[model samples]
Target: MEASRQTSPPDSISQDVNPVFFQQLRDLDIPEEAAKQALLHTGNVSAEEAAMYYFNKLENEEADGDLMYKMVFVVNMDLAMGVGKIAAQVGHAAVGLYQALQDKNSWREMAWKWDHSGAKKIVVQGTSVAHLLELQAQAMSLNLPTYLVQDAGLTQVASGSRTVLAVMGEEDIVNNVTGSLKLL
Candidate 1:
């Protein structure tokens, strides 16, 4: 005789998330779990998704507010992209920026004591500009120059504009004067 089934099915909690948001996040390479969690908790999709959504919303409405910058610096990757995208903006504003090539000790040195001497330029090899900016803002109350170089590995600076690039590979980026660097 066949045994009677007694297993309970998994609970079906239909999350109140927009399907379009899911599609957008998926297209942006965001993992499903992270995207769902971000949407549930933050009331948005992935960081990139949320940023883009807000940015577009603002643009469509012709908004001129502080949140504009807030949208671009959403994720670490986004920040890195932004740094690469805005290196010229930072430089034009006269903020000095630097990126790491292949030194650990030098990077640590810069992270430790760049702001104490009023340095304003910083370089991040792997991390995004958002992470760097967050760190810099936390470290010192002063605004510093920010730059990001793609193809670098996991790098971070908790403070200072003179922080070195904690690089494990080649610098990759050549010209920092313009935003022509590949931002992957």
Candidate 2:
């Protein structure tokens, strides 16, 4: 007996990808930005191949010792933002920091290690915007990456208000800057 071959409808195979790409991205352990770039550069042919390409590109970079790495998000307590707003501000800070570091080869290995090691993050409360600015300056002096989130004024705070500050560096060094602040 001969078996007939079954085929899916033409429309069923979308020209554009759906949720499956997300799973592929997760499985490949590629950052969203890098994955997107790889997909674009490779004509979206294969997630595994794209990830390999990106990883190979980063292989030459050196990672610091396995000492803990931490990203601290500092929110302005004086802003009195709602929980949702605070969360959004933190997200903004994180993405900003990621964007700032994504292009630098020196940060590639650190980012990879951080992602694999659970991406340790701590949210702290800052006394005020001025205090947060001071912390940003301190982080800059220490050669750490810092991102300050400014509100658009469409929702809670006034326009250009500094809402949150995100600092990324080795855990010990980061702690020195934020140790006194209370966790949010």
Residue 32 CA displacement from its true place in model 1, Å: 10
On residues 1-184, what C-alpha lDDT tens digit does candidate 1 reach at each position? Answer: 9989854435332346555676676677755643454455557545565646544644654653311110011123343334454453334223223333113565434433332222323332425555545444432232222332232333442232332222111112212221232332
lDDT of 2 by residue, 29-127 (tens): 766555655555666677766667677656633343365678999999999999999999999999999888787876766677666545889999999
By lDDT, who's the top model here?
Answer: 2
| Model 2 regions more than 4 Å off | 1-64
lDDT of 2: 0.80
- The C-alpha local distance difference test score for the whole of candidate 1 amounts to 0.37
Model 2 lDDT at residue 44:
69
Find the 10 residues in a row with the least total lDDT in model 2.
11-20
Model 1 per-residue lDDT at 176: 21
